[model samples]
Target: MQDHTVISSLIVRVLPDHGESAAARLASIEGVEVHEKLEGKIVVTIEAPTVDSSHDTAASFSEIPGVIGVDLVYVNFEDDPAVAKGSQR
Candidate 1:
């Protein structure tokens, strides 16, 4: 089987005082990248082996210190090779 990954972006709101700490935690996660930060919000991208894992990873952000809310902003789904083989171009 071929491996496909799901890529997505999220807006994470955090307590301003702990913004840096939260971002560090997010960056420590595999497939999670902290891109930008302002006020109390952070922009991040997350990738996972599957959709369920992607959502789960996003939800886990709330566990970080100072995290207020996690909002999914964008998603780029990868084409599954097995499924692609059955479809016509």
Candidate 2:
């Protein structure tokens, strides 16, 4: 872990019949924010403590019931924590 903040945005697709349940489930996950839902697609944002966790979180979205796909739109890892790890501040 680099002590950096990792934020990622993604789209999750599900069958239209399952959109509501899937969106609720996704929003219940830690650090997962469900932004919008239309048709069978949902917009979401995930905030994780590390880059690897961000990936893991995204991958887990596929396991949700009725989820057809998880498409990552963007990921940002704030700065380089490694550069300041040795400093007291």
Candidate 3:
């Protein structure tokens, strides 16, 4: 088996079904970390054991009432075959 990992960061710009309260609600999800807040958006970072987890976290954010959309600002992974694929030395 191969290990798959991913790090995802999203800038959620909320139209806010309930203003800051909406943002607050989204911040409550597990494994989701709030990196910053500016204007009407919250920046969140999610680290998961796999790509699916990362996407699941994003979906959670989208389920929030105030969430207008999620802008993926950053994503990095360590499973690329070219860089560290077999560098086990």
Candidate 4:
């Protein structure tokens, strides 16, 4: 196995909806990057050193006025047993 550090990412769908400009601004944040953005829902992916960094990025998204909610869908090298097995299988 290769020695690698786990990099967690947060997939966020911006809520309350807003303009493409605002979403662009959100994506422009230092560590945040936009993976996809359609309509009022913007999918953002943030990679950080630790889970806390992921959570911190999520919290930053919530700070955006139009943002309604933040959801974390995946993390680096997901720790789920089923997922791990599925990857191998």
Candidate 5:
């Protein structure tokens, strides 16, 4: 089966005191990348093989001890292997 690539960006809000820890936790999750972090907000990008997986990754952010909210900012899905290969040419 061809892989479906899903890319999403999220904003995660955490307790001010736990910002660093929360960012580290988020970075530890598979397929999650911490792009930027402020006092209590983190910008993250999740790359997965499917939309469900991407959503699951984002949802997991909310389960962190100090996380207050998870907001999805952007999402994209790419499922064309031929187009993917063609792009590389």
Candidate 6:
């Protein structure tokens, strides 16, 4: 079976004093990447095997201690093939 891959970008707002810590925590998540952090805003990306997983990952950001908001900025989905079938003899 093939699995769908979902990629998404989010803008997270945190308390100014906690931005650094928040970024660190976000970067720790399995498929999350913290691209930029300035003032109280953080730009991040999350990649998961499914749309539901992506949403769950994004929602997890909102549960972080200093996170004030999570706004999804972009999303993309692609199918992953289960196996390669090219052969020649």
**TM-score of each candidate?**
0.83, 0.83, 0.73, 0.64, 0.82, 0.81
1-89: candidate 5 lDDT, tens digit per residue: 43548889999999999999999999999888999998889999988887777877888887898999998899887663544666798
Better of 4 and 5 by TM-score: 5
Runs of candidate 5 exceeding 4 Å displacement: 1-4, 80-89
- The 10 consecutive residues of candidate 1 with the worst lDDT sum are 78-87
User: For residues 1-89, could you state the per-residue lDDT of candidate 1 as single tens digits?
Assistant: 33546789999999989999999999998889999998999999987776777888998998898999999999876564433555655
TM-score of candidate 5 on Cα atoms, chains taken together: 0.82
How many residue pairs clash (N, CA or C atoms closer than 3 angstroms) in each of the candidate models, in the order given?
Answer: 0, 0, 0, 0, 0, 0
lDDT, candidates in the order shown? 0.85, 0.86, 0.74, 0.62, 0.85, 0.84
Highest lDDT against the true fold, candidate: 2
Candidate 6 residue-wise lDDT, 1-89, digit = tens = 33447779999999988999999999999888999998899999987887778888998887898899999899886442221222221
After superposition, candidate 2 runs with Cα above 4 Å error: 1-4, 80-89
Superposed model 6: Cα runs more than 4 Å off: 1-4, 80-89
Q: For model 1, what is the alpha-carbon lDDT of residue 53?
A: 78
Position 17, candidate 6: lDDT: 87
Range of the 10 consecutive residues with the lowest summed lDDT in candidate 4: 1-10
Candidate 1 wrong stretches, greater than 4 Å: 1-4, 78-89
Q: After superposition, how far is residue 59 of candidate 5 from its true place, in Å?
A: 0.9
Tell me how far the alpha carbon of residue 47 in candidate 5 is from the true structure, in angstroms, after superposition: 0.2
- Off by more than 4 A, model 4: 1-11, 15-17, 77-89
Angstrom error of the Cα, residue 75, model 5: value is 0.3
- Candidate 2 per-residue C-alpha lDDT over 1-89 given as tens digits, one digit per residue, 9 for 90 to 100: 33438789999999889999999999999889999999999999988877778888989988999999989899887542532463545
